[model samples]
Structures are given as C-alpha cells and as structure tokens.
Target: MMKRLAMVFVGLMLIVGNAWAVPDGIWKNITGAPAYSFYMQTYVGNAMLVIVAPNTETFWVFLDADDNYTNGFSASQDLSGAPNSLSITFTSDGSALANMTLTGQLPATYNLSRNAQAPSTGDSGDAPTLISPADGETIAVPTSASPYSMTWTAVTGAEGYIVQICTDNSCTNVISDDNGDWTSTGTSISLTHATAGFDFYWRVRADLGGGSYSPWSEIRRFHVSSS
Candidate 1:
C-alpha cells in the first residue's frame, strides 16, 4: 500500500504554527426561528471550518491567512436563525474532547484567514445616517503628504465599506482605496492618493453583511492641487 505525502509550499514556514482553536464560546440551540438566531457577519478567507459536537446541526466559519490576532485568542459565532444556543467543542491534536457549553450557537472565523468583510444585506427597509465630511464637496489633500484620510457617516450594521474615486464627475465603478490610494484608517477608509494636477471625484458606501449595500451617499469630489 502506498501512503500519500502532503507537499509543503514555500512561505508556509513563516506561518506554520500548530493550528490552535480560539475558544470563542459555546452555543445552545440551532435552526429553529428567526430574529433570535445568533446572527453575525464574518469575512471569509483561505478555508472554511464547520465545527460540530454531539447535538445541533453543524455550523460554518471562515478565516483569512492575513489576520492579526487581537483581543486574545477568541472566537465568535453567528446564530441569526438559532432559536437557542448549544454546547460544542473544537479539537486540534494531542488533546481530549473539550468540555463545551454554550447558548446561541456562534460561528468563529480566524481573522488572518478572513478578509475584513462588509456583507450586503437585502433591503431591510432601514437607513443609517452618515456623520462625517459633507458629501459633494471639494476637499484638499494636504500638500506634500504621502497619505490622507477621509471621514463619513456610518451606516447601521455595516460590516465594511468600499471607497471609490474617479477623475470624472459622472464616472461609475469605484475601486477599493485599500491599496493606500487615500491613506485611510479604521472605519474611516482612505482616499488621499491622486495624480497631481488632476481633479477627482469620490464616493463611499457601507456594505452590510449577507448581500446588501446602503444607498450610495452623496458623492464627494476632491482635488490634488499641484505643488
């Protein structure tokens, strides 16, 4: 009989640590009703993991390869449709089954393996008020600055946001400013990178989890004046 050997790729050495499960929490019930299910929005990454124990239907979680561990080795689950919570356990290696207890089933995804995500929610018939830079106004990028930041009103239940820019006022299809085009931070994404001596138009929208986007906010235009 021949044994199968896994091929290890390069660059896997740096991040090749034992796969440890972060203890998010145990849940109680799964699959029953709505409005009470442990609902959460998570960014999917390299792999998707579903953990199951003795009872309850298996759940799903996603993780990215570029996550920075924060708030300790913790995890969370979404039980949006769960009528209650359930007890669960995760196993890696060289360990006995975990003593698990939880309510409101939670799905935990590792940030490194998951891209920070803002899901699109269907028209839930609710609107959020934005609370930063006035829309449709011309702003200036600090002279001689490598990066700049933009601010705006936050939409309710937004998982993430997308910022787009164009030189033409009537242009559509906004590109992500995540590549440092605008030098953004936190909930306020960046929008400072621009070709000098060019007038630019910009717009931003919040992405709620699932498959919904908030109505596009009023457009904003800024210019990168030449030195």
Candidate 2:
C-alpha cells in the first residue's frame, strides 16, 4: 500500500503604497484538506507563504518587499519529486490585476479572481476557554514525534490567540512555545517540551490587533508526568 501525504501552500505579498503599506497575497479558503481554492490580487514582490501538514501543523514563511526594480526577489524549494512536490511559479508587475497560476495536481486554479481582502479591526469578543487536560488533570509528557494536543473553544470575531504556559500558578516561569503562537485561524495546537515531569499553568487571550486584546481567561493547571 502507498503512504498518504497531504500539504497546503499559501503566499502573501505586501507593497508600499501612498502613505501606508498594503498587504496582498494568496489566501486559502479553510475548507479542509484534499481540496483547495485560493484568492489573491496581482502577484508582485514581497510574498508570504504558509504551509500546513500533518503533525507539523501551520507554518508561515515570508519574502521581503522590494521597491527598487533593480532588486528582484525569489524563493526556491526542492520537493524531491514527492507526489505533491509539483514545482510552480507565478508573477505579476502590478500594471493590471492578475490571477493565480497553479501547475501541479492541485484541484482548481483561478486565473481571473479578485483580491481576498484582509480583515479590518473588528470586535475582540471574549476570552477563549481551555479545553484539554481537564484543568487539573495529569497527562503523559509529549515527545518530539508526538505532543500534547492543546485545544480551546473559539472566540467570536477573533483573528488570533496568545497562549501562555508557565511553571507556577503565578505564571512567573514561562514555557516556550514550539508551534509559535497558536493562531486563531486554527482552534487546536500541538504542545511539546524538551524536559517534562513538571506542573504547568496556562491561560489564553484573544488578539484583536491595534494594541487591543480580550481579557485573559481563567488560568488552568496540569501536570506532566515523568513516567
């Protein structure tokens, strides 16, 4: 039997305009895996790419914007001819609107689509409630191959979330996040640590951008067993 592999790729481009800078790029409709349709404006310079895969979860990589025509930008990858490693490249000069060009086993590619506008500052809503470990339960330590699955309820109108794991109830010693910030785009995240066998306190908040965030949720406690 052949092994199954799944992957999703998204890119964003930001250009300096007028008195401010504008962000544009490929935005994937979060309609699960095995099927995908993206939205974007003309493909220019300064691109951001987000990759999602099993176990690894969500990751974002960016290419800086260049205003000088002489300074061109580029990115490269070697998929090693994997089933999903279909090489593709697209570009636009911004002289006119352009659509995405996909070359691979991708489901559908849009050639005359409109820009997928970014969300503006909206309601911050309420704090996200912690859902795993049962608030005082003990769980096995997470390994590099497998990690504790931290999860929580989604907040209304939330663009993202800030998660904090600590050693004490006061949260004086902060635990490092392996998966970056658990972005609100996804409700669950994998958690891991080099050393375990410790008690951990955690809390979460809603990020509304522009220096605004929802109040932190009530802290929850959990213990990572040594065995």
Candidate 3:
C-alpha cells in the first residue's frame, strides 16, 4: 500500500507539472497583416504578454494567476483605449490559434507560428539613416493636398524597413494607425494625416528577416503646424 501511494503521488505531480506548462518566446501571426505578434515571458513567477499590432502598437497584458495555462491561456486588457480580449490554444509546440476581440469591432482569429529565433537589436552600423523631414523641421499638417513624405537611406542587405512615428522625444508613445506598422520594401513612405499642433519624433530600422532587425536610426523631431 505504501508503494502504491508513492506511485500515485508521483503521477499526480507529473500531471500538475504538465498542466502548468505555458508557451514562451515570440509567436508571429501567419495568416494576415498588419502583422500581429505576441511575446510571452515569465518573470518572478508572473506571466506577461506583449501584443504587437501591425501599426506597431504594443499592448502589455499581465496575467493574474499562474494557473492560467492549461494547454492554453486567455487574457483581457484595454489596448489603445479599447477593451480587448485574447485567447490562445496551442496546437503544437510550434503553432497556435489566437482568437481576439476588441470592443466595437468584429472578433478576429489568427494562426501563429513560433519564431525559430527571437528578435534582438542588431548592430547600429546596420541601421538606416533618416533622410527627409529633416531633424527639427516644422511642416504643415499632413493632408491630401500636402501629403508629407518620409524617406531614409537604404541599408545594403536590408529586406525591408520599419518606420515609427511617435509623439514624444523618447519615441515611446508611437502614433497608432489602422493600416499596420509602417513597413516598406522601398526607402520612402508617405503620410496623409498626423495630429497637427504637436511635436513628433520618427526613426527607422532595417528588417533583415528571420527575426533579425537593425538598431534604430538616430531619432528626429518635427512639429506639425495646425495651419
């Protein structure tokens, strides 16, 4: 009886351990764009989720319980001022299906694949150089009549580039858009509208593919005039 009880205890422990297993690392959406991704991490026994939208808006969700993962996890948070909920189920170690819902919008589903390598900041020498809307230049508000163009010097081996516009000098508060993150295979991107009467900062980075990216270019600041 003693031996049988020990075996049962060991089996229960194994089941409990497997039940607590959660997916970690970066998972990118395979189905569509604007590209969406999630970065799952655990720190000090706390589970954290970072959601990246096509427009480069990042939403961080903190899970309340460690027991949230039972072959999958679910969470909800306010993202970009909208109430958003996310549910993910692991189909395999390398694949998952995510169901997301945002207030006032249709619920959407995504097929995800784990990146073989997580993205890390690459050498600054490989970063792109900002060209137009020169640092500190004030410009008329972007409009159809006066659309503003942003340009950057191309990197030699770059497959693409990412442009981020922010409202702060530090570039933490990125400007949000519905089209997706500003990614281009070319050197320039045009903007039709940006909030007028505010200072804006911009930067560029080269996308080298396979989860590799160059360090951001030196940030540049510009102001948009309401007139």
lDDT for each residue of candidate 2 in 134-214, tens digit (9 for 90 to 100): 798888888768888888888876677878787789766776665554444566667766356778888877765432355
Q: Across residues 1-227, which tens digit of lDDT does each residue of candidate 3 receive?
A: 00111001101011110112223445555555332333344333444433434223222222223323223434453222245554443343323333333322334554555554444321223779898899999988898787889999989778888898998888888875568678889999888888888889999988777544566899999989977
Count residue pairs with overlapping backbones in model 1.
46
Instruction: Kindly report which residue stretches of model 3 are placed more than 4 angstroms away from their true locations once superposed.
Output: 1-125
Off by over 4 Å in 2: 1-124, 178-184
**Which of the two candidates, 1 or 3, achieves a greater lDDT against the reference?**
3
Residue 154's lDDT in candidate 2: 83
Per-candidate TM equals 0.38, 0.43, 0.49
CA lDDT of every candidate: 0.37, 0.47, 0.56
Clashing pairs in 2: 12-25, 13-24
Winning model by lDDT: 3
lDDT of 1: 0.37
Q: Which window of 10 residues has the lowest lDDT sum in candidate 2?
A: 53-62
* Residue-level error in angstroms, candidate 3, position 66: 34
Question: If both were scored by TM-score, which would come out higher, candidate 1 or candidate 3?
Answer: 3
